[model samples]
Target: MSGLQPITRSSQLSVEVVWLSAADGVLRYRSEAHPLDGGVHPDDAAWHVSGLTLCTPGALLHSTSWRYARGSVVLTYVALPDPDPHDTVAVPTDAVTSGGGPLHPSPAVIPIEAVAAHACRHLALLAVTDPQVAAVAAAESPLWTLITKLPCAPAGTLHPAQTTATAPHTAC
Candidate 1:
């Protein structure tokens, strides 16, 4: 076969998707990426996900999960959004230093589909690079999976807790 086409890394994209239960939903959502600013949401899927990780604050209340699938990975975490009503901040990509010092592991959340695709692309490299990772392919193998799979409220939707009416995206 001819060389597989490269994955898009552009700042823009678009696609339609089906949003089922936030718990066990698989989707085909298309994303539109725009060069991200400080506080606004990402228009692109990759940026959107990475932005999720960045917005998710590291905390004592925060937890971790992992799923070492035979050929895929999905990551998730509890995030703390920006504090002030208009507070736009930035965190380092490699490592972020908090008032206390460098924070602990900040896991990245990639959808199962993305994970599967990555595995297909890097199978050979992965086989030789990390065989042990290949042995376990369950959705609950990695710490990030636990963090992501935990049944949390959906974005822009409300569940059983609060008394006040917050915005849709504030569903926590």
Candidate 2:
């Protein structure tokens, strides 16, 4: 019975993104609030986000990218704003559909460097906000171990000094 444990899907598993402003460096949880009130726009080049998606059997997806000079990250797939008409060519009116129409574009790929950078920031935030979790993370906990194993996460990114617990607490 101690071997491999049976896996089950849990509806309680969920995911959400935490956004940061590239302009002013403000942090906000993504929600229904208006962009002016802390919400985020998918196409806004001035915003970035970091989040985790937990799938069945323990899969995790981290959304982050390094292509932008400012280091932007997006958690979900989004349709980019259309290009300016002046930079486009007119399509033929006689075009026919193959099946229905064009397929949805794939989500943007995030580089490991960006993902690691964001994860480090999130860990620091958690340490500051929750002493309990911070204590666990600071003790070389499994969660911290998993973060260090991320294929994209660079070495020394999860150093103890960076993710150290801010509040005083007994070691577990």
Q: Judging by lDDT against the true structure, name the best candidate.
A: 2
Q: What is the TM-score of each candidate against the true structure?
A: 0.18, 0.21
Query: Where does candidate 2 clash, by residue pair?
Result: none
Cα-based lDDT at residue 147, candidate 2: 33
Tens-digit lDDT string for candidate 2 (59-124) = 222333222111222233111111111222222212221111124222234333343345444444
Clashes of each: 33, 0
* Clash count (model 2, backbone only): 0
Candidate 2: stretches off by over 4 Å: 1-110, 141-172
TM-score of 2: 0.21
Task: Tell me the lDDT of candidate 1.
Answer: 0.27
